[model samples]
Structures are given as C-alpha cells and as structure tokens.
Target: MSHAIGAPLIWWVSDYTLANESALIVGDDFGSIAKVKLESETGLKDIEIIQQNNQQLSVRLPATISYHSHALRLYQPDLKTFERVWLNAPKIDWLQGDMGVKTSTGQGWLQLSGKNVDTLNLQDAFLINKTGKSYSLSLKESDPWHAVFNLPKQIPVGSYQLKFGQKVTQPTIPPLEVFIVNQPTDFQQRVLNIKDFHQSEDSIDHTIAFKTALADLATHGGGTLYLPAGHYRLSNSLFIPKNTQILGDGNLATHLIWSKIDKQESIALINLEDNTRLQGFSMYHDDAAFGINSPSDRVINNVHIEDIVIRMSAYRGHPTSEMLTKIYDQILKRFSNKLDTIRLQANNITLKNNDIYGTGRSFAFIDSHGINIQNNKFYNGRRGWYSFSGCSEIIFRNNTITGADLMASGGGINTLGNKVSSRNLYFANNTLGMFNGWDREAFTSDGGGASYFGHVQSHKENQLLLATNLRSKGLRLTPYEGAVLFVVDGKGVGQYAKVISMSENLVHLDRKLDVALDNSSKIIICPLQENYIIVNNTISDAAIGIQLYGTGLNHVVYGNTSIRTGGINLLGLWYGGYQSAWYTLVAHNALYGSANTRKFNPTRTDLHTSNITVEARPRSTDELNLVYGIVIRNNQLYQNNGVSIIGSQNARKNMDAIFVDPLDN
Candidate 1:
C-alpha cells in the first residue's frame, strides 16, 4: 500500500500494551522509518524494531513503562507522524498484602497487591514529596493484583505518597504514604520536636520557633510536630498547614496558652488546614474569642482532631439583646459568629474525644459537609452547640452538652437552616441539658430549629410559581436546585417535590404535582432544612426537647427520652409571615409533657421565636402556617396533652398527624 505525501500512515495495531507485552504495529509506508518512539511527560524511549513484514513493524514494549495517553512518534528524514493512545487499562481501587516501600536491603522498593494491578502500566506513577517533587519508578514483578517497583536511590529521605494516574483535584480516595529513612531505627525518631527550634529556654514567645519548625518540616516533606510536657505561650494564631500534625505529650501535660495583646479583635488561636491534625494537647485562651477554626475560603479535606481540650478562661456572660441582634444579622446572611470557640467551615472532618468549654457558642459549623462529631463534651456559658446554615451529612452523636443557656433563639445541637439549606443531618445517642437548677421550663424553642421564607403564587403540573422573587441578593442566575417545595395547606397538602431548577418567580420540580392545587392552596419553598434524623437522645429540663420549626421535610425524631423536658415539639413556624413542614415521624419516645404539634407565632413575646430574626422579623400574615404528614406513635406522654394540636391556624384545617398503636402509653 502506497501513501500520499502527508506522513507515515498508521492503520492499526495488534496490541497497544501499557506493560511489557509483544505487539505488532501494521501500517503503510514503513520502509523509510528510521526511529519509532514512545513519549510521555517523564521522557522518551526508542521502541525496539524486532523485524518487518511488508508494511508491518514487530516490536516489544519497554520493561518498565510509565506513560499516560502518550504519543507513538514515527520519525524519518523530514517526515514524521504521531499516533496517541490512552494507556490506563486497569482500575486501582485499593491495595493489600505487603505494600511496603522499604525492602530488606538499604534500597527502597514497592511490593504491593491490590485490585486490578496486573492490567496497569504504572502510568504517571511517582512518589511525591510534600514540596511536590516527584521521583520516577522502575517496575520488577507483574502478577494478578500484585506489583513490585524499585525506587530511585537518589530520592531524599522524607515522608512521601505513592501516587498513580491523574492528579486529583477533589477529595477522593487518598494515595498511600510512607516514611523513607536510612534505617529502621530512625522511624522512632521521625517526629520533629518543637523544642529543637527554640534557641533559649528563657524565650517566652514560641511563635517564631513554631513557624520555623513547621517551615523546616514542610521543606523535607511533612511530619508530626511534637510538643513535650511543658507550657508554651503563643502571641499569634498558629496555622497548621496541609499534610501536617501538631501533637503534644498528653492533654493534661502539654499546654498552649494564647496571650493575645489585641483585645478588640477576635481570631482563632489555632487555624487548621486540609489533611491536618491537632491532638493530645490542652489549649487555653483568655483575651481573644475564638479557640480553633477552619476558614471557608480554604477548601479542606479529611481533618482529624482528637484528645484535645479547648478552654475559654475569660467567659463572656449571657448573650444580651444586642448580641442576639448581631447573631441574627449573621444568620440572615448565612454566616456564623466570630466569637464561636470552634467554628469550622470545611468538609470531611472528624472531631472526637475532646472537651470544649466556651463562653459563647461552643461549636459553630457553617457551609460544611460530612462532619462527624462524637464522643465529645461541651460546656457553654452563653449560647450552645450550633450547626448553622448550609451544612449536610453531619453526624452529632455520643456527645453531651452541659450549662447550655437554651436561649430563645437556639441552644444544644441547633441546626439553623437558610437559603443554602441543611440536609442529611443526624443527632443520636446524645445528652443535652442545662447545668443550673431547672428553674426555666424546657421548651422546643430552646432546641433544634429550621426556618426560611415562603409565599405561593400559582401551581402548574411540575412547577410552582412563586410570589417572592429570588433574583435579589445576586440570586437571579443562581438556581435553587436542591431546595424543596411543599404544598402544605389546602388542596395539594402532604405532597412535596424537590426543586430541579428555578427562575425569577418559577420553580421546576422533579415530578408532576399529584394533587391538584388552586389559588387558595398555600405552598412553601424551603431552602432551609431537610432529611434529618434526631434519635436515641436524652434531654432534661428543656422546654422542648426537639423542634423542627418553619420549613423542613422527611425528618425522623425517634427513640428519645425527655426528663422534665417539654417533649418533642414540631412547629410550623412563621418566618417572615410564612412556614411549612411535612413527612416528620416522632415515635416511641418518653416525655414528661405531651408531644405537641402547633402553629406558632414568632412575633409573640411568649413564643420566643425572636432568636433568628433581626430586621426581617416574622409578621402575622393571612397565609397558612402548615404542618402535615406528621406521625406520632407509641409515645409515653406523662401529661394530658398527649399528641395535642395547638393554635387554630390553617395547620388544623387539613393537618395530617397519624396516631398509631395506642396514641399515648
């Protein structure tokens, strides 16, 4: 076959091996070819030309291949052509068996057994340092689900991760890391000591020393920064960088005291980064407000904090009306308080086995996801433990809160939802109470909550036309994709649909409306809260144990006990004159009071709903306050208000509270 005056034409190949496999490359006009090469980012290598049959070239691949979508370059005198191919044939899920980086000898090698390792070509494989320097590898053994590669001897001694395939941009399965040392005995001394950076024992300021140690460790990759049994004073906040850990001898032995000279400004004494940890230490802050924080700007992944104690010595007194106003302002803007002891705005965080005592809100999480906070104790002097707007997949379990003020706005595991919405939250196996003598009755207004704006205009097949325009606050182009729309009153009651997209005054739903709705029907669009589980918890001396206020749906409150508490109260609360809730299950609980469903007024003085509103307070309107699809079953109500319905609002018109199997035991 003769080719035109372009370049050497490539027809096809028998096998495009990413590994060491013999293959035949058949094409036209191969007589004038001088060199055939396989090129990747690492470098280039010449392919061995075994023989030629007509227009075919028989070749053998390199023994150790490291390529990803590389091009095969066929070179001739002033005539060249390229053919690109993807080399990733295997799926590397996880590793097992002897995946060690160090061999018996002084040299370094990787021998591992993993899923689908045999089909891989070791494409783009490297051992990366913390400073982002990569070293190449040479493969040795190739077997089913097993691999062996020799590491370069010139690679420096440090901590490194064995990374493969494409560079990761999001949080996913992490690559394996290993410590490279000269000998096995050096492994015990791998931890960097914080005292080594200090020049003199007389130095009261350890900030410079701490920063110097962190920079030094980051230069040679990352490792743990150890603090021995001693007290250190820091004038500035310590920002623990990514892929690092700051550990102490023990929580009782090692202490970090924040002596803030600036009294007015509030800043976190410790700021955490992605892939970072702070453990085995006791932190004390007196002058400044915040204890530890993860800022929202920095996208974090997989942070673990354990065996630590955060104590605020200068406790701010009970929150006044002015302080509450400031909190409401922040909430309306979907922000958190600056004075929270531990304010986290990151994802995939595990905070456990710690004791936190704060003057204001002990814990405040905003716009975060996948947070697991368990086995912890919180002591609050003012507000309480709050998980605010835009948080989801949160598990708050096996924890206890004491001395909570249970303020009218919120207290004790509060989930305050807003436009971004809170979803997939859980509170289980926890204890919540106030330490002071039970002077104030426990109420639902003091517990969990969710709220948002609502107004109904017209309803179509799969859309809800709204009266309120969402184009304000720069939300014109922003679609309310994950929000929920519920027909809470009148014709289409008990049916809800998820928002697929939204225009200025229109909402597209996931499915068509099952029940026909008219102008008299009251529909609510909740961008506040959804899909929560509050179960297996113990509460005492609270006016309301668990409350789902305002707009929420598909929430489960089961297997909880209330001792002197007001019991589980679900309120279809009016925020900015509208509210709705549906598909809530409150079952198998023991309470001192009756389990109640009510339509509450936020503006009433006794209602205590002013906690969440600043300027945009809840106003009494003609629109319906609605709660439907409520199931209260097998609950032991000690009082006569068992499964009682309060308020003669529109919720009583078509309120669906299904009582089953002995309404009250």
Candidate 2:
C-alpha cells in the first residue's frame, strides 16, 4: 500500500469521552483493535488498545493527557490499515486584550499565550462582527509567536471578534473595536489651549504665541496644540514636531491665514515631521500656500491629515481676466501651473476627508510607500495627485476631482518614473473631470519603463537595423544588452530576437528572424514589472481616460466607464531597459468616442469595431511583436472597425476569447 504524505488522519472524540479519558472516538469502521502507539522523544511507545467498537475504542495511557502535545498511531491487523494523527491540546492563558483603536488600514498587535501556539496558521483567521459580517485578516508581518494584522480599509466601523482556526466551533479570542476618529483616546490630556497664550482672532502676529506653544509642547514630549475658532494670522511657517497633532474647532470655525508682510517667493504654511496629525482646520494662502512640507530624509510615518480645508491663491484677491483666460485655457486645453498644495516625501501616510481648492498641484508624493489618499475632494487644482521617484503600494481611491486647469501638463493622477520604478500602484473608483492641454490624459505615465521600435531598416548577420521612432534622444542603451525584442506586426510577427547593442536609431540583434519584415512591422522591448490593478473608475470630459507608456507586467484594467474621452491608450514600451507591457487584461470598459474629434483625441477607439489598433510600421526582415499574453475580451465597444488584433490572432466579431501561454492552456 502506498503511504500518503501530509494527509490529516481524522479522530473525533466526544466531550464525555474527552472528560472521562477512557474511550476515544476514531470515526472509523474497523471491527477489531490491533495496535496503538504514541510518538515519544526517543521513539514510538506501544500503548494497549482495549475494548473496541465501530466508533469508539479505549486506549491505556501512562497518565492523563492533560494539555500536552501528542502524536498517536493506529493499526488494524485484520485489514492491514495504518494511520497517524497529530493532536494539540490548546490552553489560553488570557482571553482578552486591548487591540487599540482600529482605523481604516491601521495596524495593531495582540499577544496571546497558549500551548502549541506555533502551529497556528494565521492565514485562515478572520474577524467576525456582531452583525455576522466577517473580514479576512492579512498578516502584515510576524514573528514565530506574535503577528500583526492589518484592518481592512472597507470594513465597517464597529466592534468585532478576532477568531482563529478553521473549525466552526472555534471560539473568538478577544473583542476588537474600531473607531472613526483619527486621534488617540488620550489626546485631550495633552492639548495646549491657545486661549491661555492670549492669542485672539484680531491679532495680526500670532507667530510668537504659536511658536512658544509648539516649543512648550515639544519640550515635554509632543502633544496636541488646540486652536480655537478664530482667524489667526501667521507671518512665518509653523513647524510641527514629531508625535504631535494640531487640532482646531472645525474647518469652518478655525482659520489660519498667511499674512506675511514681506513678499516671499514660496512659503510652506505648515511643516510636519514623523507621526504628526493635522485636523479640523482651514488654511488660506495668498499667492501659493504650501500646506504640509516634509523632507525626504525624515523617517516620517503615520502622518494623518484629515477633515481640513486648504485654499491657495487666497492672497491673489480676485481672479483677473488673464488668470481666468489661463484657467479657461487649462480647462479646455490641459495646461497646468505646477504648484503643489502639499509636498511630501514620507511613508505610511494617510490624507482623508479633506477639501482643497485653488492649487496648481493638490498632493505630491515622492519616493514614498504605504500612502492612502481617499475620500477627498479637490476643486480648481491643476493636478490631483502626482507620484514619482519610485513610489510603490500607493492607492488613490474614491476621490472627487474637478476644475483642474493644468494647462498642458499633469492630470487627475500622474505617475512618472523619473529616477526609479513605481510598482504595485492601484487606482480604484475615482471620479475625474476635465484637464488642460490637447495631449493631457486623465491618468498618464511618461518614461514608465518600455520603449517602442520605429521601423526595421535592414536585417543582416543576425542583426536587425531599425529606425528610432519614439526612442529617447539621450537614452543610454547599454543596460539592455540581454533584453528581448519581439516583432509586433507584419510577417513573422510573433518572432523575437535578443538585443545586442542599440545606438541612436539603430538596433543590433543577436538572432536572425524566421521571416522577413515589411513596412508594417513594429517591435517592442520586453522587461515586465508586476501588480498594477486599475478597476471600476469613471472618467468624463477628458482627452484620454488612461494612458500607459513603457513596460508594465501583470496589470489589469477592468470595469471602467469613459464618457466623451479616449477610453484607454497603450502607447510604446521603450526606455532602453528592454521592458514590455506583458501579461495584461483590458476588459469590460464602456468607452464612448466622438466621431468629430480626432481619432487619437483622448476619445474612445471603438473597440467594438476596431478593437485594439496596432500601428506597427516595420520595414526589413525583422518582425514586430510588441505585446504578449494580453487578453482583450467582453468589451462592449460602440463602434467595431474590424481591423484590430488580440494577441497574435485577429479578433473575431464579438467573441469571448483567452490569450495566454499556449502550452499552459
């Protein structure tokens, strides 16, 4: 008989038998008892198997099992059956512990003592609410005995019970409570009352009192500095210390207006450090008021800015005709002013439920991680979100953006790979409006990671000479020595060659093409990245809904609706790093293109008629293969051009299909 590995041998015992410690219910149909043994430190020790029934049998043990680890083996002599079972008797030293205030995307730790605790698999654990709703727990990081779980962002704010194990009868360990407030429970104990400093709304220079209060708070460890309902003027920037919070009455009640007597070119109204919170206040800046400024080198974490309103351009008095013209040009043409309301370079930050008006750039994150920007409203801003310099795991969700006059730059959300790579970035369920500039997109990335091939001029000696189309003029190509270049169109379209060297418009290959190319051939470099999901978003009155440049891997663009905008545009993948956008799925997007607009005018390209339009223009024997492992299906395109291709095969008239590795299917 073949022995099965890693299979659990089930042995069920009743509560009465468990207490009596005589009979054990094996739940098997064996008629006679043969042999029983228990695994010990030295080896297996034989135990007598007395009095047997179909469901129950008695085992003679040296002592009471108690709460100890045991492994038992059973053998049936008549049928020659053998089985092994591992049992863990668990004991809880403590039943309840505080899990702290659970905010959305917050983390907390709980320590519990129990026998055989190391065998617990936290992956199967969940938190059950009183309303019978269960939220799955994700183990962010863990040690051998302790683990921290992240609270789900969408979980309802309520009390919940943390549960472990897969069995239905498993009991909850402790009760966890989630609060809607962002401040700590003991926040009131550390508040510095502004009234004690004799600062009033009529004071033109509250800088002395405000600075003194902040210094006093920092001297005795950081705490909350409360500002009452008043319009206080500050001539200089207010620097916030670590582990400090600046609280106010409310956005409409508390106001901090910048009244700098001497004209300064740029001014940051508030500067923050690590673990800082700014809430329930309003700020008014004249020319351009910087909201929060945190430098890159600081170890800033858990910086929460919520329930605040920031109004830039407040000192500009009234909008001039030239400003209005510029705004109109930006609204209609996609031009931007490039001013940021908040400049941040930090990690583990959350900006939620705030109102921002009249800014060039609303929020900017540079080389940061664990950033959450949600439930915020932006009005009259040139850009809503700008992330660059290798930011990862950034989420922009459920934000409403309108009246962005960015001129010819920026968009609702822009991710640029200026110095490093941006990975695991997600944008979900956002409402976007008009942008400035003719070439502006609702969501755009420039120099992302991939490059495109212009045309194949000639093929000889296993090398393909190509003309540069959208290749960067000063692009250094030596780093892509071993990268794969595939033909995206023409004869032998799916064929690929290894890149040897690239100089300006010329590309040298390391392999000969299986077939020659023509003027219709286009090629792409393939060095794919990972984990980009864009789902369930709505874009209206924009030039382009979403435009992806360079190379992206394992990405999904699904369930989006575009009105009066170009639905999705996937441009070239060429950045001299030999990266291609592969393993992508573009599905179920409703895109409406206007006929009067230009074909590429950020307008939808009738996927129903044209599907994906591949413009591969290659000339020589080298083929053009730009994309791979792409699935474009179930899309309801308004117009079908009958000329688009899906993967290596021509798309059928309205057929659902799959495109993947042929051998895997």
Largest lDDT belongs to which candidate? 1
What are the lDDT figures for the candidates, one per model? 0.58, 0.56
As a whole number from 0 to 100, the lDDT of residue 146 in candidate 2 is 28
Residue 46 lDDT, candidate 1, scale 0-100: 85
Best candidate according to TM-score: 1
Per-residue lDDT, model 2, residue 177, is 48
Q: Model 2 Cα displacement at 7 (Å)? A: 27
Judge candidate 2 against the unseen true structure and give its global Cα lDDT, from 0 to 1. Answer: 0.56
| lDDT score for residue 475 of model 1 | 41
Candidate 1 backbone collisions, by pair: 442-542, 442-543, 442-544, 443-542, 443-543, 443-544, 444-544
In model 2, the runs with Cα more than 4 Å from the true position are 1-189, 200-202, 261-266, 296-299, 318-337, 380-385, 406-417, 448-529, 575-579, 593-624, 639-665
- Residue-level lDDT of model 1, residues 439-508, one tens digit each, is 2322232122222244567777887776667665334334457766666556544556777877777778
Total backbone collisions, model 1: 7
lDDT per residue (tens digit) for residues 1-665 in model 2? 23433222233321111211332433334344477777666677777665565534545454544433455667766424566654443323222112212343234423333223333556766778777888777766432222445656566545666676643222233544433223333445578977677546576678788888889878877888999998877788888877788999999999988775332523478888877889999988765445677864664666788999998763265788888666545533432444567778877667889998755666667767666678998764543444344455555679876655544233532234333345555567888766554454666655444444456766666766666633554554555564457665554444556667666666777866645666566566543334455777887666567666555544567678766665575543234433444445565667665322322434565422222332221122333334443545445566432214433233211111123111111
